[model samples]
Target chain A: MSDLFPEEVRTERLRLECESVADADLGERYASMNETAIEDGELAYVPIEPFEHLQEARDFVAQREDRMESGDAGTYVVRPRDGEDGAGYPAGEAELFAVWDERTAFMTFGLRKRFWGRGYSGERAAALLRLAFERLGVELVSVTHLVGNENSRRAIGKYVDRFDGERVGRFRNQHVIDGEPRDVVRYEVSKADYEASGERPDCEFVEERADGGDGA
Target chain B: MHVGVANLDCLWENRRVHTGVSLYRPYWGRGYAGERARALLSVTFDRLDLDVASVAHFEGNENSKRQMEGWVEDFGGREDAYIRNAVPRDDGDAEPWNLRSYSITAADYRDAGGAPEVELDPENVPEPTSEPTDLDRANDGGDGA
Candidate 1:
């Protein structure tokens, strides 16, 4: 477990943990958000059938974990405090997940419907990015809004320094959203840009599981 | 919303003013592309404080071109330069393609950042710089011509 993570880092707004293969249940739950997210994102970018079931979610999370363990990707979980769902947390509704390569971060909190409309996304993201920049030493992080997800767009907009207008190119073969392909609207942020944004990089959050374990 | 450009690793070698962009066709009418471009322009000029912010596209892809055009007008970008046949469409045969460019100088965007700071209500953030009328515009260009 020690080797699995660099060290336990806590902020007033979130707890950053490293996820492990054992945390398949969290992955499963995250996968559950796919159908809803499809309506919010992928449905607008490209066509993709809503994902249903734990196996698929587990598999995807496994892949992401592999990336993290192998140093190809960096993953972090969002554990919001109880109540105060402003950060998109309805106290045990879902887990916030951020996956990324050196240049991009794909953020999706495995949250429930109850978490929406709260300021959870923005506040939590600020803490996460702070950790990403100070500890992870990442250069740029990117995300996408699957068209019509104005909520995602609005929420995500706060975390990144919007630049270059680019749409998601064909990501593999897509068909879940009615057989149409998609181009997820892409967004990104850089270390330099992050610092430059005049945002407070030192954010606050409580602590939680690092290997993708549910704090609950 | 603000997003970081790639760490000028090899991207920001010079003070070129252009952005690499792609947006969903479904969200095409939303003007987010322009909004984001303007915001980036703000970053380049006000935050990172670079002298010029840029954006690019192929010669014929009007869809992409149109977005860049709005960026030029909205983000304080200038329509002064071009890269000839830099991007070639892949056909049976390869060919040189034009990579059109647009940009906002640091001075241009900093001044732009000062007004009507755009805010995301719940977020309560930066006031967006809305286009000013003749008098406001005169004061905006106050420091120089």
Candidate 2:
């Protein structure tokens, strides 16, 4: 289980890279995010700091290393094929994170406003599901949607099966964005359901090799 | 048959009284159906520690009824509890229906042989945690969506 985290995942259409401090303008880019943009998006919550400054974002990524080591946290960058042009959104569609046992991952996608109507969200979600199951070996994965988020709910429903009955629950104010202290609906997918979905489990994966002379 | 997964999700395995049997047409007349059913009997009678296993067949499924009859000769005897429409085949598109049952015991399974062994990786089992944590993580096996 400790070996579950992978630094990068390259699917057919997009590349999912876990962000570190070295990555581009994460701080300033994330800082540039306005509260309105986040509220409109119905994200978990907008951070207190107005701008996502370099040090702030770097420290965030650095804190992730500590969290991950203790099996408490993880974050990844979604890089879509269409490069991030002028808009500040990260190129990829979304990211998955599991803090502790990593039983199941919770995912959130970030397709830019321009890419809204495209079908990339579901496609990328399926790819991420594969990573969680075959790669990370999770038994289940669940997603939460803010009440009234019909678009996100529909997108999520079209993806995973096992649609466990929804339980209204509360999440963090700043950590999750659906707004302050709001109740959300939960949906989940179990390994049994995912395997039963008739999707192919036989995709060939090219393991990202590490540098260095190796003669194992 | 594809054995629609939807049926399983409905908790088919937990049903107190349900029986389903299928055989490939290509493998007919080879007693494969009987063998298939005896396998389930072994699971119920042996591994499940059930005192008896109930099996059934209807008027149209003579092959299946015959299979159950054979098992009785080996270890037990049977009597009809009631004539019932276990599965109605009255519909034009449906198949035939007849019903019968049997009881197999753990003792019988032990006498015949044993159930197959299963192994699971102990490490993968997640430890449950209280529900108040904010990280979507508990002691371990956490989620944060």
Candidate 3:
């Protein structure tokens, strides 16, 4: 149970590595990507305030480590498998927050501005959903985005639709952004829904891929 | 006179709270649940200055469903989602509950002329006017009634 999620999950185009404070380089990359998101004003759409200093992001990494150790969350750095160009750096972050009592987990992710236009959102989500359903053994995965965030609307919509998730309607005043109440669009994919979807994204655990290293 | 309880739980942020009402079996349908709910909404939107008041009921809890259906729209609320595995059971034997959820924004509350002005009092317990029913539990899931 403690080892429900793997250390690393690989999609065809991205590497989702578990966030670990023991790895100073991974911590640096995580903090650097966060700074980039803050500078790009991407944090405006997210619920959190921008990091005031580099150490804040580093502190956040340490906090996430505590959460992971408590079995309440799994945080991963999203990077391109091929480190060519700037894509090899931490492109974004993917997260799964457990609601263990209900057998459900919340899925959230974000990418730096430079990585936005590409299909990385869906690709990363594919890997995260596989972790939630296949590895974590949760009964349901839920996703919610601030209502006016059109980028997230499109990105979450595409991946959620492909997995046959239900678009639970726009909840009014579901969240507060910048001191103003705002709406949120929620989506959910049950284990049954994922199993029934014909177009689910392909993902493989790194160890599985290495073990089955076949020439076919 | 001591019926049950009403809850206004801070949910996501200060902007929203999840509200629910539960009355003992003897106090089932004298409209105490509705009256308390109306006052709770008044507090939620008017006094608390909160943005939204949300509530939900388990799938098979017809008593709560009827209560919500009766007044949710009159207060300008709407059904938000049917969330699967949303509530855990105290019994610990069966699966988590599938809930039918709803919410009312401050704007919606204002648009519907808001809940009728009612003063909230902690000691204001309603006197039972009807006999306890053996029909069904009004607050089966402890979520709402």
Candidate 4:
């Protein structure tokens, strides 16, 4: 297993940092936003139950940190670049997880309702794709959205090559939205497709090491 | 002793299996690959009662591409995924090859009259060679890339 992705990525308006235990407060905030989104029927694909307490958020962050250490997955906290200095809450999350032998990974992201419609989702997703292809050497990245999630579809479409048709599969009631089962739409982008799109995020990656050595 | 071998990697949870086949160079172009694939598909669909069976090959491997096409045309398989530069070549200078994956469902397999029959002759099987070929390593592990 290799730690190929950098610790932090900065776009023009957002900074995507690897989630850590120290970011428990941010995690708590994210959990609250997720709960709101779910309750409002704006999000339906999340499998886990909403967090009831801050402790759950801390535990989630700890588990993510462990997965990052094992090189299996990573979750990034999306925050404003010019936001407050310390203990700032995350506006959203962009995650690349379920890495398969460093060859492929799954992408998922969301923005807080307050941050929606700001074009930040596209920026953050582009940055994550760049990290997946350039840093992790992944050949393909996949994303899925439940049917009727037009916002997610649009956000993910920004990075995908439209020439390749999306694959639709029946989840057989996998997602219960408004008490009805819905199918899922899956989209995949290959490294070649990403390179061909010529859409690169204006971002800087900052590598942070735990051993006090400059990441080379 | 072996003229070739076929493999079925069952993903029981997914109700699918991944198939792979390899033959000695001298045995190539004899339609053995297709026959072995049919037999394996039988095991996957009939014996294992699996829902889907999938296979993949590098883009440049015309033999494999042709065989997969045969299965698709005859057994109603469909192209499932194509990942660019997914299969790294053994030669360091050569570029990584694109991978084309295909899948067939048990319903399709049954509609195609199950699996084709292949004759087996244990008496003519050759002794195993000492040297390990790239295909051997690929078939043994490492995602059969």
Candidate closest to the true structure, highest DockQ: 3
Model 3 docking category: acceptable
Tens digits of lDDT, candidate 2, A1-216: 135555555555555555445544564546544343344543332223433445665665565545445543334555454443433245433656652233556777655454555556676677767767776766666677666666767777676542332332322111233223332555566666677776843222324324220101
Query: Where does model 2 exceed 4 Å of error?
Result: A23-52, A64-74, A82-89, A99-102, A161-179, A201-216, B1-145
How well is each residue in A46-112 modelled by candidate 3, as lDDT tens digits? 7666565767767777776676677777777777776435645777778888888798999888787
Query: Which stretches of model 3 miss by more than 4 angstroms?
Result: A30-40, A83-85, A207-216, B10-13, B91-93, B120-145
Please give the ranking of all candidate structures by DockQ, highest first, separated by commas. 3, 4, 1, 2
Name the DockQ score for candidate 4. Answer: 0.06
Off by over 4 Å in 4: A1-7, A26-37, A40-43, A46-49, A52-56, A67-74, A80-91, A96-106, A110-119, A130-151, A161-200, A204-216, B88-94, B116-145
Per-residue lDDT of model 2, residues B1-145, tens digit only: 3211100011112222123455435656776555555555554444343344444566556776677677654554343332222344545134324345554444555675543443323465323332222322221332322
All models: lDDT?
A: 0.48, 0.48, 0.75, 0.67
Give a tens-digit lDDT track for model 1, residues A1-216: 223234233456554445555754554445445565444532343323455766665665576566556653345544554444434222221122333322233444433445556666666566656655665555545455555557777767655533321232211111223533322455556667777766764554333444444453
lDDT of 4 at A111: 67
Off by over 4 Å in 1: A1-13, A23-54, A83-110, A161-178, A202-216, B1-145
Q: Chain B TM-score for each model?
A: 0.61, 0.51, 0.77, 0.75
Model 2 / residue A51 / CA error / Å: 2.0
lDDT of 3 at A25: 62
- What is the CAPRI rating of model 4's predicted complex? incorrect
In CAPRI terms, model 1 is classed as incorrect
Instruction: Give the CA lDDT, 0 to 100, for residue B105 in model 4.
Output: 82
